[model samples]
Target: MANDTKIFHESWYRIANEKLCLRSSVKVHRQLFRGARWYVLSDPFNNQFYRLRPEAYEFVIRLGLDRTVEEVWMEMISAAPESAPGQEEVINLLVQLYQSNLLHYEMPPDSAKLFDRYKNKKQRIMKSNLLNIMFFRIPLFDPDSFLKNILPLIRLIMNPLGAILWLTVVGSAIKIVIDRFAEVSVQTQGIINPSNLFLLYIAMLLVKTFHEFGHAFAVRRFGGEVHIIGVMFLLFSPVPYMDATAAWAFRNKWQRILVGAAGMITEIFVAALAVFVWANTSGGLLHSLAYNMMFVASLSTVVFNINPLLRYDGYYMLSDWLDIPNLHTKATQQLTHLVEKYAFGYKRSTSQAYSLKEAFWLAIFGVLSGIYKLIVFASIIFFIADRFLLAGIIMALICCITWIIVPLVKLIKYLSSSPKLERIRLRAITVVSILLLFVVGFFYYFPFPNSFRASGVLKASEYFVVNSKVSGYVKKIEIEPGSQVSAGQPLIILENKEIDLQINEAMASLQESYAMRQLALAERPEDLATVEARIQAIQTRLDRLQHDREELVVKAEISGVWVVGNVADYLGMWIRRGAPIGQIINESAYYFASVIPEVHTSRIFDNEVKRASVKLVGQADTEVPVFRYVKIPMEQTILPSAALGWKAGGDVPIDPNDAQGVHSTEPFYEVRAYLDNNNGMKMFHGRTGKIRFELTSEPLLRQWWRSFRQLVQKRYHY
Candidate 1:
């Protein structure tokens, strides 16, 4: 039920439920009149709200109006012996109510109008605050505004996408292909490197940015401003993001639909043009453009941008055409109606939306959708001293939870009071409690804390994985199976007889010197001096021998993934230093890896650590567990290498605009996010799942927005 008061805490709600008795000295706003303790009241029956100030209460009691219109209407139709309900009386009552509504509407600047005006002003203030929240006072995402925000030098960049936006996507791809295949002429060394594909990919991203511009352009043709344009991530994958919330404000539904369709149309046209140019052209420039064009145009914009089920241009497209105020709302309403019809056997109507299907969907998802929106709002509102505001939110949430639970609680109380109806009440309470729990759990916890749970592979450090250096015949390997070793631990011993003999000779010399010194104790000058010299020489020999002994030890230089191998153990086996042998990998190594095409790479944001979850296979099946990255990779690889591992990089997607020129020709960027469930795999590598990365979305002005929308729709509601 909708309430249009300033605010009410959980305590007021408890008072409404009689969980906490109303206080006589409550600091309620008072006027010259009688009073009743009604801090807030929810009219769920009609999904309407009434603000009862002291004066309103006084007016009601003074008029002795014992019945509201809804109550009067009910009374006339009630099957009571005392009540007379003839056709004439029913018609008269209906006429009277209509007359009353007409009178209420006619009164100039009446209470409702004044209330609405006050609400409108409140909305204006709220809107201003929200605009500031998103980091601007007036959030106008016009073309001029965009150009102004971009660097002066960047203005040199052609918005070729604007002319034929998707064509750029196609053109870039074909250009890259032809450049690669049409035989590299004796020219710049830089042109030959495959790593150059990364640049083409970046160009594709620039094109997609204009793809959003196409959407904005269409929307602006009507009146509303485009407030936002940027990359969007759903799950963790990137998508060219844009905010078209402004389009809905237009009077015509067709305008909204046109705005939704604009981007896809633009992308398609661009992709087609790129294909055409590639097919017809034969010059070096043309060949390069044509080769890359088709892939970029089709891959980025076609496959990625048109998936309505995935929440991109497609989602808005469907939402606009269906005439749903919001697709998300409609989805929830539709589910809610399903639950009501099948689950509840067609019981309740939904508070939001037009039809049962819409309401049902919404109701089914009401708890989840509400929480999701709240979290998205939290992301945007984080700077609004959100923690302090969250307390208020928590209180408000508790009040809603209590409202949902009240019916079941009352039913339980009734069942306890009367044993005969216990079974019926029990069934009713069970269903109600289950439904209520859905809402309660949403408030308590579900998506908020767990939203960012994700994981990826950890790579070995460069020092950790080392091949055998200075190898000899495998005399003895020091480490045993399953043994853990520290850095510099002895792991192997090479046969070196010369070093062994030196050690023995040094020991013998030391012993001989000691005996001679004992024997020459009395010889003061010449004999004693000679003995001292001999002792010093022996000590030096021993030191050199020990230093040589270190070479034979073959110690482990680093700690990590140790690759154990069975080798040929023979006395005369040939060996070379820094040659092929068993490998060692650093257990604590890390790297970032991914296989993203050029189009999607454009959407990769820097410095924003997206959530990831890594999974490993195991013997026993278990619930999916998510993991977090220890650290973001310091450097991205220029060309795929073994040091980077798998050409795939550490499960971290290397946005390869530089590597994959194919995507540069696309009109829109496509990002794929892989989140792993690492809970079950103890003895295996990471397992992953697909996440539909969504860039965060929001209404420009969130606070009390639906409240204003409701006010407008109320005028039109029959």
Candidate 2:
């Protein structure tokens, strides 16, 4: 017998004399886990599978109508004494097999217990479905027959040649996207537009359909059956899914891994095909639909499927690669094991991990997955609530109940009533109570660094808008755009033939008037006053014409960077009077103009700002110090710069009605933080960045409550 095996269990006498055998309908398959042989008991009727180690499998096979369970156990111990399972292990094995309907009892009345077990299993499944309301599934039909019919075709594509083709197509599609990256990026901003929602849903459906089919084909190609094809309501949106778990029975771990990754591979291929369609077509329903398909495929595969932290395709692949079956469940159990064994000081508590290395991985994965799940859940809730408040509220409530309330209730029950904690119950209770209190107190009392960030653009403290004083055509650009120029330097020269001609005519008239004035003075002293008046009028007109002609040359109003749009495009283009040609900013003086959400305005207004800093995009290391700030109390929808809107790749939500994208959808308070001039930082006008306001330290719970209150007030006006 193995040294680690328990000699006997107290409950062994109850099932010692019972005769049981493996059900005829349940098929057994051999597989390897972590280089150890394991037998998989597959129940064909229910499509359920269970794994059993060699020692347990031998004992199970020994069971028959004539032999008692104790006799079978004795035989198992005699055959493989070193690796035989203990009596407690035997009891657990039998209970699990009976619950799974993989065992049949000789006594007919014992069948009632089996029936009850099956009913309980069904009820548990129903409860699980209810808890996972956001991801509920409804089985539609069996796809085994359909998969068999398409097996040959699947084999043809699930090969090396198909892989080569996939690479070629996907590579070309990537190149196409890279070539027009800017246009594609701009188009992506409207992906969730109300007008395009229907098309987006359709594209998502198509991509997911192909993705499921890919799994089905892979399973069939690897000699596995895919029976259940269903619609999974992912966040209340129906998407097709298939049962590809039969691949778990495959002996080759690589085959199982391949099956897990097939869905994502298929999605990428679909995205590539959609990219081609989008690139080839112009503006139309087809082009838009293709773009949506590309978006859906890439988003689903990357953010959801390929993320190893989530229990999706990538997670399963990682599990198979690491030879960890039921990784999530085991990792969760490992966490519990740590709490009970170490935290509660329960020495008898068993670990779910097989080795120290595995325990470390399980611990790390468990913590990371839990955190990621919370982030994803919160993000989903916010996203849904932003669109549908009532639906989001309902989902949040249900998820809180299932994820938080239920687990807490279970933990309390375990601490109070579990038999294993009988000896250390008091200590365990005290430890858990302290932990709970610590967590609550920490959140409610501990002061954390409080700050809020807003997207802003750099602006000059004082700037001059260079405007044409007189209407004229631009003849030359004396100073290039983006060049530094001194004040009064000629920036552009304008030509106006009409103004020049007027000046010449006025001069000629003045000369003629002077000659007439002199002649009048000599011939008739009475006509001298009229001639003098005529000469004065002509001289005034000539002076005005000369001034207008001189105004044709535009000069810089300030000594700063000459910022203008395409100087070459403006050459020969007629500019009207008072039209803005360019802006000459005082580069030495700068300020950051940031828009604060109306809800968050109270934080800045009520509290004295401790400090503020600006971090420009692509220059994260440089912190520009803010000396003074000016807050515009009035809420306005106008953005200081278009770069702070969605259309310009900024984080602010823009108003669709405003074509220029400089208008925001919601009203915000504009805050201008004057930057330090002596910081040796060259700030550019309209350069977008984030400005963080350091406020008084506040507790996280208080901050959260304040945010929630503000959210309700802003969203519901309550």
Candidate 3:
């Protein structure tokens, strides 16, 4: 309900009796937001929409040629005094409508003023286009005729039956995709390769064309015209786009949402079809194309189209779903209202939100959008800079001017010249200056706790691997895995019948040679010496055979816990010479081996390490402290264990071709920190964990700058 008290500006009072009315060309549409009735005034010629409150809508509806603005105001006050807009609000509403070309005066308008307004609007639009050069659009032919021609053919599928069919196709595609997920994932990595760039772009174009058509067709299905179809230069790449603003006039929220969602739905359907093709077909050009289509379609739909942070299809869909039109503008207004009302003590500043819940959403969205825009813009600038340095620098400067400089200049202008700040300019300036100083001081002077974490694995200080000394068959398993065994303890028992037979034959030969030597000794001394030498050779051969037979049993070389991967599988199996049986890990002495990226090595060496702790992946609640540490100077591409690589579902990236997942894509410095074992932490040889090194406290701003520089260096090799 509007306040019954009538308040008007002195200037508004001068024009209170002026005759004004809504233009015949302007159309009004009723809408509801947060359970409150509101009206949307649209200028179809200009494709502009302005939302009005119930009281304002009532005032607009009451205006006519027969009654002056004063007459309408009096009649409104007499009818619904509690619900009628005050004189100040009435003047403001009329000004907004007139500015929007939605209102007309009884008197002839000044041609010079009208032309100046038109030129100013054009200049603003052109300036916006120039600022957003990365996403500038080039309008092509109208898509309405093309849509009309195809509307009849696709009209049948634009219904419930088509929805069911789409669901079925998507469901089947999902199953096929799941079955071949590994294959698809591997192929997706090649999409960004220079060799595949052409095909990838082609696929992207085709998919986006389909996407835009989906929007156009959906609008046409709902009795709306798609006047413009164009190519948007998104990040220097041309992608199809369409203007489906006719859906804004939709009365049904769901209809508007459907139109917004139709593009994504179409892209998903194309991706589904691509999935089927890619799954059934063997490796070839067609298969590659299909895969690229599926990749681009799915990726763009999720990352861009469906992301509500972007002003894309998902943004509109979300707006309609929440019954909040012009969500972005309203969110900005809410933020401005907060700053004015609380920060500047502008008590008269009214919130754009109808309720607390709406205010909360608007505030949250406002902050999120601002942050997201900055991140996205910065990322794009960096990405382009990495490739084309000079072009990237120019673009960055332009973006900085448009996004940062312009806004700051506008803010300064508002603070100095805005009429609303006239009464409390000094107070506002003092408050704003203090706030800015506080923020800068907090970021610069404050010492924040600094820590960096890296993935690592717990490894035994020493490991004793038990291997077979001779080729034999495993006859018995003596010890189970994880069992503590003493040095020379039998871990596995093996039997070899061939070695036993050889030993027996050598023993018999030795006995024969000894007997012959005795016989020769009686005949001749020289012959006896030769026979004795033969007997000695035979005896040595027999001794070697016996030693080989005794080597069948495998024993632990050190006292530690036995770790056998699959001891049961080796039972009764032929063991090759030097084949590993199991390992004896000294769990009492353990250390965490962490791989630190080469870029972060400077920070590690520069800062004094205050403390360190290790948290096992699964048991993250427990933190084991490091007693001592040693940094290895060597740069290596081979990961210490597969548990710390991408192939094994870990955070580090490794060569996919490596079967063991041990080969890292980038070289890293290894650091081993001795763990305190007194806590009786269950230590495994290759248990994956994260090791955090606490460094000396530093200002947050400095830390962030360091981290950002490190990121740039690592990603772009700058």
Which prediction has the highest TM-score against the true structure?
A: 3
Which 10-residue span in candidate 3 carries the lowest summed lDDT? 108-117
Q: Where is model 2 more than 4 Å wrong at Cα?
A: 1-7, 75-81, 107-119, 179-190, 193-195, 275-289, 457-499, 509-541, 552-592, 614-627, 637-665, 674-689, 711-718
Clashes of 2: 0
Structure candidate 2, residue pairs in collision? none
Model 2 agreement with the true structure over 260-336: per-residue lDDT tens digits: 98998899999999999999999999999999998998888878898989999999999989988888988898888
Candidate 1 Cα outliers beyond 4 Å, as residue runs: 1-213, 219-258, 261-315, 321-368, 381-493, 496-527, 536-540, 543-617, 620-718
Q: Which ten residues in a row have the lowest lDDT in candidate 1?
A: 13-22
lDDT of each: 0.45, 0.88, 0.84
lDDT of 1 by residue, 230-325 (tens): 554322224466666656445555666677777766655655565556556665665454434444555556544665543457666766565554
True-structure RMSD, every candidate = 21.4, 4.7, 3.5
Residue 42 displacement (Å), model 1: 35
* Pairwise lDDT winner, candidates 1 and 3: 3
Q: Highest lDDT: which candidate?
A: 2
**In order, how many clashes per candidate?**
83, 0, 0
